[model samples]
Target: MTSSDPGALHAQTLSEAPCGRRLFIHALNAASGEGQEWVARLRELGFIEGEPVQVLRRGQPGGEPLAVRVGVSTFALRRAEAACIQVMPADAS
Candidate 1:
């Protein structure tokens, strides 16, 4: 991958991932308190390592709610929640 690519050798948070590119779950960033809850919920929703994920669409200009598909399930996640998911490009692995 090129240097400009966010998922070249490292993981990028889902919220900052470019739309329409197929990516894979690299890791989950679990913070304290509510952030941990979000991460846990995300895991329960099938956001796991090695799983394929894609950014279907984004909300308006600000890009708050992101339409993301993980495996065979799609979810609408806010930027904050999406940030909990760390993903790498499909070819990274």
Candidate 2:
């Protein structure tokens, strides 16, 4: 995968993000991180380390908006924005 490609970096879903995996903020397109608002929101939503995330959907064809579940809330984030966040498969088994 290219250095700027988030989706290309990994191909696993949230349900597969087990419990002790390490995931990187690959992208977050329209989610917005300006002024750290998005970052704060994400943390509040439980998008922190050791948290499990599942990829509900890949958004549209371009992968702009993706449906992901962090902790108990599901959010639709833009590709560019998703690229900023990082994550790893929680399940190592």
Candidate 3:
């Protein structure tokens, strides 16, 4: 919440979220075409508003796919996909 950028507190994509951080879904930036498919898939995976999400693991230094826990399920997402999930720090929420 102390981040210089106010949006950093209110909203930031999961890709930028630190590992082991617990957060809440603020919104999902569902897009068209390929992203539209991801949006639908993510929704089916239970990436919805108000639900808690946690960054469990991440790819090595490259940081490609990130493993995350959403609700009671765990899934791996590419940084591009993770970037569409906007969330707020758990404490702030």
What TM-scores do the predictions have?
0.86, 0.55, 0.83
Highest TM-score against the true fold, candidate: 1
What overall lDDT goes with each candidate model?
0.87, 0.53, 0.85
- Winning model by lDDT: 1
TM-score of 1: 0.86
lDDT of 3 by residue, 34-72 (tens): 888787788889999789998898988898789999999
Window of ten residues with lowest summed lDDT in model 1: 1-10
Question: What residue runs in model 1 are displaced by over 4 Å at the alpha carbon?
Answer: 1-8
Candidate 2 minimal-lDDT segment of 10 residues: 24-33
CA deviation > 4 Å runs, candidate 2: 1-35
User: All candidates: CA RMSD in angstroms?
Assistant: 4.5, 7.4, 4.1
Global fold similarity of model 3 (TM-score): 0.83
Comparing 1 with 3 on lDDT, the higher-scoring candidate is 1
Q: Worst ten-residue run, lDDT, model 3?
A: 1-10
